[model samples]
Target: MNFRAEIDIMPLKELLDPQGKAVSSGLKKMNFTSVEDVRIGKHISIKLSANTKEEATTQVENACKKLLANPIMEGYKFELIAE
Candidate 1:
Protein backbone atom coordinates (compact mmCIF):
# COMPACT_ATOMS: atom_id res chain seq x y z
CA MET A 1 0.00 0.00 0.00
CA ASN A 2 0.99 3.60 -0.51
CA PHE A 3 -0.05 6.73 1.30
CA ARG A 4 0.18 10.45 0.77
CA ALA A 5 0.53 12.92 3.59
CA GLU A 6 -0.13 16.61 3.79
CA ILE A 7 1.24 18.47 6.77
CA ASP A 8 0.89 21.97 8.09
CA ILE A 9 3.04 23.42 10.86
CA MET A 10 2.57 26.79 12.47
CA PRO A 11 3.54 28.74 15.52
CA LEU A 12 1.36 28.65 18.60
CA LYS A 13 -1.14 31.46 18.87
CA GLU A 14 0.34 32.83 22.10
CA LEU A 15 3.80 32.90 20.64
CA LEU A 16 5.08 36.02 18.96
CA ASP A 17 5.51 35.76 15.20
CA PRO A 18 7.65 38.60 14.06
CA GLN A 19 7.70 37.53 10.46
CA GLY A 20 3.95 37.14 10.26
CA LYS A 21 3.36 40.45 12.00
CA ALA A 22 5.76 42.14 9.68
CA VAL A 23 3.99 40.70 6.66
CA SER A 24 0.64 41.77 7.97
CA SER A 25 1.86 45.27 8.54
CA GLY A 26 3.30 45.37 5.10
CA LEU A 27 0.04 44.22 3.62
CA LYS A 28 -1.80 47.03 5.36
CA LYS A 29 0.65 49.54 4.01
CA MET A 30 0.03 48.14 0.56
CA ASN A 31 -3.73 48.78 0.98
CA PHE A 32 -4.64 45.21 1.85
CA THR A 33 -6.01 46.30 5.19
CA SER A 34 -8.46 43.48 5.59
CA VAL A 35 -5.64 41.08 6.29
CA GLU A 36 -5.04 40.67 10.00
CA ASP A 37 -3.55 38.26 12.49
CA VAL A 38 -1.53 36.79 9.70
CA ARG A 39 0.67 33.85 10.56
CA ILE A 40 3.10 31.99 8.33
CA GLY A 41 3.82 28.28 8.34
CA LYS A 42 5.16 25.42 6.27
CA HIS A 43 3.27 22.89 4.19
CA ILE A 44 4.77 19.50 3.58
CA SER A 45 3.64 16.92 1.06
CA ILE A 46 4.98 13.42 1.40
CA LYS A 47 4.49 10.10 -0.39
CA LEU A 48 5.35 6.87 1.31
CA SER A 49 4.60 3.19 1.53
CA ALA A 50 2.32 2.19 4.42
CA ASN A 51 0.03 -0.68 5.30
CA THR A 52 -2.71 1.63 6.47
CA LYS A 53 -3.71 5.26 6.83
CA GLU A 54 -3.26 5.02 10.58
CA GLU A 55 0.32 3.89 10.16
CA ALA A 56 1.02 6.66 7.72
CA THR A 57 -0.43 9.19 10.15
CA THR A 58 1.68 7.85 12.95
CA GLN A 59 4.82 8.02 10.88
CA VAL A 60 4.09 11.56 9.81
CA GLU A 61 3.34 12.63 13.35
CA ASN A 62 6.58 11.19 14.59
CA ALA A 63 8.46 12.93 11.81
CA CYS A 64 6.77 16.19 12.67
CA LYS A 65 7.61 15.88 16.35
CA LYS A 66 11.17 14.95 15.69
CA LEU A 67 12.12 17.44 12.98
CA LEU A 68 9.28 19.23 11.21
CA ALA A 69 8.09 21.45 14.03
CA ASN A 70 9.21 22.99 17.30
CA PRO A 71 6.80 21.40 19.80
CA ILE A 72 7.39 24.09 22.41
CA MET A 73 6.29 27.01 20.28
CA GLU A 74 4.56 25.42 17.31
CA GLY A 75 1.67 23.14 16.47
CA TYR A 76 1.33 20.69 13.61
CA LYS A 77 -1.42 18.72 11.92
CA PHE A 78 -1.44 16.24 9.08
CA GLU A 79 -3.75 14.23 6.88
CA LEU A 80 -2.95 10.89 5.37
CA ILE A 81 -4.67 9.48 2.29
CA ALA A 82 -4.35 6.40 0.18
CA GLU A 83 -2.17 6.80 -2.85
Candidate 2:
Protein backbone atom coordinates (compact mmCIF):
# COMPACT_ATOMS: atom_id res chain seq x y z
CA MET A 1 0.00 0.00 0.00
CA ASN A 2 0.97 3.63 -0.50
CA PHE A 3 0.12 6.62 1.61
CA ARG A 4 0.42 10.38 1.47
CA ALA A 5 0.90 12.52 4.50
CA GLU A 6 0.25 16.22 4.82
CA ILE A 7 2.03 17.63 7.85
CA ASP A 8 1.86 20.97 9.59
CA ILE A 9 4.45 22.24 12.08
CA MET A 10 3.83 25.26 14.21
CA PRO A 11 5.19 27.01 17.24
CA LEU A 12 3.32 26.56 20.45
CA LYS A 13 0.76 29.22 21.23
CA GLU A 14 2.60 30.11 24.40
CA LEU A 15 5.72 30.89 22.43
CA LEU A 16 6.53 34.04 20.49
CA ASP A 17 6.71 33.81 16.73
CA PRO A 18 9.08 36.53 15.62
CA GLN A 19 8.68 35.75 11.96
CA GLY A 20 4.94 35.89 12.19
CA LYS A 21 5.07 39.12 14.13
CA ALA A 22 7.37 40.67 11.60
CA VAL A 23 5.06 39.69 8.81
CA SER A 24 2.11 41.09 10.67
CA SER A 25 3.89 44.33 11.24
CA GLY A 26 4.70 44.53 7.59
CA LEU A 27 1.09 43.98 6.75
CA LYS A 28 -0.02 46.70 9.14
CA LYS A 29 2.46 49.09 7.63
CA MET A 30 0.95 48.38 4.28
CA ASN A 31 -2.51 49.38 5.57
CA PHE A 32 -3.69 45.86 6.15
CA THR A 33 -4.77 46.76 9.64
CA SER A 34 -7.36 44.00 9.73
CA VAL A 35 -4.60 41.43 9.79
CA GLU A 36 -3.16 40.77 13.21
CA ASP A 37 -1.59 38.08 15.32
CA VAL A 38 -0.26 36.28 12.30
CA ARG A 39 1.38 32.93 12.77
CA ILE A 40 3.82 31.22 10.43
CA GLY A 41 4.21 27.48 10.15
CA LYS A 42 5.62 24.81 7.94
CA HIS A 43 3.68 22.50 5.69
CA ILE A 44 5.13 19.26 4.41
CA SER A 45 3.95 16.42 2.26
CA ILE A 46 5.34 12.93 1.84
CA LYS A 47 4.48 9.77 0.00
CA LEU A 48 5.70 6.39 1.11
CA SER A 49 4.97 2.72 1.15
CA ALA A 50 3.00 1.24 4.03
CA ASN A 51 0.84 -1.77 4.81
CA THR A 52 -2.06 0.22 6.21
CA LYS A 53 -3.23 3.70 7.11
CA GLU A 54 -2.34 3.13 10.73
CA GLU A 55 1.21 2.23 9.81
CA ALA A 56 1.47 5.29 7.62
CA THR A 57 0.21 7.54 10.36
CA THR A 58 2.69 6.05 12.80
CA GLN A 59 5.52 6.59 10.37
CA VAL A 60 4.57 10.22 9.79
CA GLU A 61 4.18 10.86 13.50
CA ASN A 62 7.54 9.32 14.22
CA ALA A 63 9.17 11.43 11.55
CA CYS A 64 7.66 14.58 13.02
CA LYS A 65 8.75 13.70 16.54
CA LYS A 66 12.24 12.58 15.60
CA LEU A 67 13.20 15.01 12.87
CA LEU A 68 10.50 17.29 11.50
CA ALA A 69 9.26 19.19 14.55
CA ASN A 70 10.88 20.54 17.69
CA PRO A 71 8.78 19.05 20.46
CA ILE A 72 10.08 21.49 23.03
CA MET A 73 8.40 24.52 21.47
CA GLU A 74 6.68 23.24 18.36
CA GLY A 75 3.77 20.92 17.66
CA TYR A 76 2.79 18.90 14.63
CA LYS A 77 -0.32 17.47 13.02
CA PHE A 78 -0.74 15.27 9.98
CA GLU A 79 -3.37 13.83 7.70
CA LEU A 80 -2.85 10.34 6.34
CA ILE A 81 -4.39 9.51 2.98
CA ALA A 82 -4.25 6.03 1.57
CA GLU A 83 -3.17 6.02 -2.04
Candidate 3:
Protein backbone atom coordinates (compact mmCIF):
# COMPACT_ATOMS: atom_id res chain seq x y z
CA MET A 1 0.00 0.00 0.00
CA ASN A 2 0.98 3.56 -0.63
CA PHE A 3 0.28 6.40 1.74
CA ARG A 4 0.59 10.16 1.67
CA ALA A 5 1.38 11.90 4.89
CA GLU A 6 0.53 15.53 5.44
CA ILE A 7 2.41 16.99 8.36
CA ASP A 8 2.38 20.31 10.14
CA ILE A 9 5.16 21.52 12.40
CA MET A 10 4.71 24.53 14.61
CA PRO A 11 6.44 26.35 17.40
CA LEU A 12 5.11 25.51 20.82
CA LYS A 13 2.37 27.86 21.88
CA GLU A 14 4.34 28.85 24.96
CA LEU A 15 7.18 30.05 22.80
CA LEU A 16 7.46 33.29 20.89
CA ASP A 17 7.25 33.27 17.10
CA PRO A 18 9.32 36.19 15.89
CA GLN A 19 8.71 35.49 12.24
CA GLY A 20 5.01 35.33 12.74
CA LYS A 21 5.08 38.52 14.76
CA ALA A 22 7.06 40.27 12.07
CA VAL A 23 4.60 39.23 9.40
CA SER A 24 1.69 40.28 11.55
CA SER A 25 3.29 43.67 12.10
CA GLY A 26 3.84 44.05 8.42
CA LEU A 27 0.26 43.21 7.71
CA LYS A 28 -0.98 45.74 10.25
CA LYS A 29 1.28 48.37 8.77
CA MET A 30 -0.26 47.62 5.41
CA ASN A 31 -3.69 48.54 6.91
CA PHE A 32 -4.72 45.05 7.81
CA THR A 33 -5.58 46.10 11.32
CA SER A 34 -8.04 43.32 11.75
CA VAL A 35 -5.14 40.90 12.05
CA GLU A 36 -4.44 40.35 15.72
CA ASP A 37 -1.88 37.58 15.77
CA VAL A 38 -0.05 35.29 13.42
CA ARG A 39 2.01 32.15 13.75
CA ILE A 40 4.08 30.55 11.06
CA GLY A 41 4.56 26.80 10.60
CA LYS A 42 5.81 24.24 8.12
CA HIS A 43 3.76 21.85 6.09
CA ILE A 44 5.36 18.64 4.83
CA SER A 45 4.12 16.03 2.40
CA ILE A 46 5.59 12.55 2.24
CA LYS A 47 4.69 9.58 0.10
CA LEU A 48 5.80 6.11 1.10
CA SER A 49 4.99 2.45 0.70
CA ALA A 50 3.88 0.31 3.62
CA ASN A 51 2.17 -3.00 4.13
CA THR A 52 -0.52 -1.56 6.37
CA LYS A 53 -1.97 1.72 7.63
CA GLU A 54 -0.41 1.10 11.02
CA GLU A 55 2.99 0.74 9.47
CA ALA A 56 2.54 3.93 7.52
CA THR A 57 1.49 5.73 10.67
CA THR A 58 4.54 4.48 12.51
CA GLN A 59 6.86 5.56 9.74
CA VAL A 60 5.44 9.04 9.57
CA GLU A 61 5.51 9.41 13.35
CA ASN A 62 9.10 8.27 13.52
CA ALA A 63 10.06 10.69 10.77
CA CYS A 64 8.51 13.56 12.62
CA LYS A 65 10.09 12.67 15.95
CA LYS A 66 13.54 11.90 14.63
CA LEU A 67 14.09 14.43 11.86
CA LEU A 68 11.16 16.55 10.80
CA ALA A 69 10.32 18.34 14.04
CA ASN A 70 12.24 19.68 17.03
CA PRO A 71 10.46 18.13 19.98
CA ILE A 72 11.85 20.68 22.42
CA MET A 73 10.63 23.77 20.62
CA GLU A 74 8.14 22.47 18.11
CA GLY A 75 5.17 20.13 17.95
CA TYR A 76 3.81 18.24 14.97
CA LYS A 77 0.74 16.50 13.70
CA PHE A 78 0.09 14.41 10.61
CA GLU A 79 -2.65 12.74 8.65
CA LEU A 80 -2.28 9.73 6.39
CA ILE A 81 -4.24 9.17 3.19
CA ALA A 82 -4.34 6.12 0.97
CA GLU A 83 -2.79 6.68 -2.38
Candidate 4:
Protein backbone atom coordinates (compact mmCIF):
# COMPACT_ATOMS: atom_id res chain seq x y z
CA MET A 1 0.00 0.00 0.00
CA ASN A 2 1.05 3.59 -0.50
CA PHE A 3 0.14 6.91 1.05
CA ARG A 4 0.28 10.59 0.16
CA ALA A 5 1.61 12.91 2.81
CA GLU A 6 1.05 16.65 3.01
CA ILE A 7 3.22 18.64 5.38
CA ASP A 8 3.09 22.26 6.49
CA ILE A 9 5.80 24.06 8.41
CA MET A 10 5.40 27.41 10.16
CA PRO A 11 7.32 29.57 12.55
CA LEU A 12 6.58 29.45 16.26
CA LYS A 13 4.12 32.00 17.59
CA GLU A 14 6.81 33.82 19.52
CA LEU A 15 9.19 34.02 16.58
CA LEU A 16 9.27 37.28 14.68
CA ASP A 17 8.74 36.82 10.94
CA PRO A 18 10.45 39.77 9.33
CA GLN A 19 9.77 38.57 5.81
CA GLY A 20 6.10 38.10 6.46
CA LYS A 21 5.85 41.54 8.01
CA ALA A 22 7.68 43.05 5.09
CA VAL A 23 5.34 41.45 2.62
CA SER A 24 2.34 42.64 4.57
CA SER A 25 3.70 46.15 4.50
CA GLY A 26 4.22 45.90 0.77
CA LEU A 27 0.65 44.75 0.31
CA LYS A 28 -0.65 47.75 2.25
CA LYS A 29 1.42 50.05 0.09
CA MET A 30 -0.22 48.45 -2.94
CA ASN A 31 -3.63 49.50 -1.48
CA PHE A 32 -4.42 46.08 -0.08
CA THR A 33 -5.32 47.52 3.29
CA SER A 34 -7.75 44.74 4.07
CA VAL A 35 -4.86 42.35 4.60
CA GLU A 36 -3.58 41.99 8.14
CA ASP A 37 -1.25 39.91 10.25
CA VAL A 38 0.40 38.11 7.37
CA ARG A 39 2.62 35.12 8.04
CA ILE A 40 4.63 32.83 5.77
CA GLY A 41 5.29 29.13 5.88
CA LYS A 42 6.42 26.17 3.80
CA HIS A 43 4.59 23.20 2.42
CA ILE A 44 6.04 19.80 1.56
CA SER A 45 4.61 16.65 0.04
CA ILE A 46 5.85 13.09 -0.01
CA LYS A 47 4.77 9.60 -1.03
CA LEU A 48 5.33 6.65 1.27
CA SER A 49 4.66 2.94 1.33
CA ALA A 50 2.83 1.72 4.40
CA ASN A 51 0.41 -0.94 5.51
CA THR A 52 -2.00 1.46 7.18
CA LYS A 53 -2.85 5.10 7.59
CA GLU A 54 -1.59 4.94 11.16
CA GLU A 55 1.81 3.76 9.98
CA ALA A 56 2.02 6.41 7.31
CA THR A 57 1.09 9.12 9.80
CA THR A 58 3.72 7.92 12.20
CA GLN A 59 6.36 7.94 9.52
CA VAL A 60 5.48 11.49 8.50
CA GLU A 61 5.45 12.68 12.10
CA ASN A 62 8.85 11.16 12.74
CA ALA A 63 10.22 12.77 9.61
CA CYS A 64 8.90 16.15 10.73
CA LYS A 65 10.39 15.82 14.19
CA LYS A 66 13.74 14.60 12.97
CA LEU A 67 14.45 16.63 9.85
CA LEU A 68 11.51 18.49 8.35
CA ALA A 69 11.04 21.07 11.12
CA ASN A 70 13.14 22.83 13.70
CA PRO A 71 10.98 21.86 16.65
CA ILE A 72 12.37 24.63 18.83
CA MET A 73 11.58 27.54 16.55
CA GLU A 74 9.07 26.02 14.13
CA GLY A 75 5.87 23.99 14.18
CA TYR A 76 4.68 21.34 11.72
CA LYS A 77 1.53 19.43 10.88
CA PHE A 78 0.79 16.68 8.36
CA GLU A 79 -2.02 14.72 6.82
CA LEU A 80 -1.84 11.17 5.51
CA ILE A 81 -4.08 9.79 2.80
CA ALA A 82 -4.03 6.21 1.56
CA GLU A 83 -3.11 6.07 -2.10
Among these predicted structures, which one has the highest lDDT? 3
Provide the global lDDT of candidate 1 against the true structure. Answer: 0.89
Q: TM per model?
A: 0.92, 0.94, 0.96, 0.94
What are the clashing pairs of model 1? none
Report the lDDT tens digits of candidate 3 across residue range 1-83: 99999999999999999999999999999999999999999999999999999999999999999999999999999999999
**Lowest-lDDT window of 10 residues in candidate 4?**
74-83
Clashes of 4: 0
User: Cα deviation of 8 in candidate 4 (Å)?
Assistant: 0.7
Which predicted model would earn the best TM-score? 3
Give the C-alpha lDDT of model 3: 0.97
Off by over 4 Å in 3: none
Per-residue error at 24 for model 2, in Å? 0.3
Question: What 10-residue stretch in candidate 1 is worst by lDDT?
Answer: 50-59
The order by descending lDDT is: 3, 2, 4, 1
Residue-level lDDT of model 1, residues 1-83, one tens digit each, is: 89888998999999999999999999999999789679998899989998877788789989999998999999999888787
lDDT per residue for candidate 2 within 1-83, as digits (tens), equals 98889999999999999999999999999999999689999999999999888888888989999999999999999898888
Worst 10 residues of 2 by lDDT: 50-59
Q: Against the unseen true structure, what C-alpha lDDT does each candidate score? A: 0.89, 0.92, 0.97, 0.91
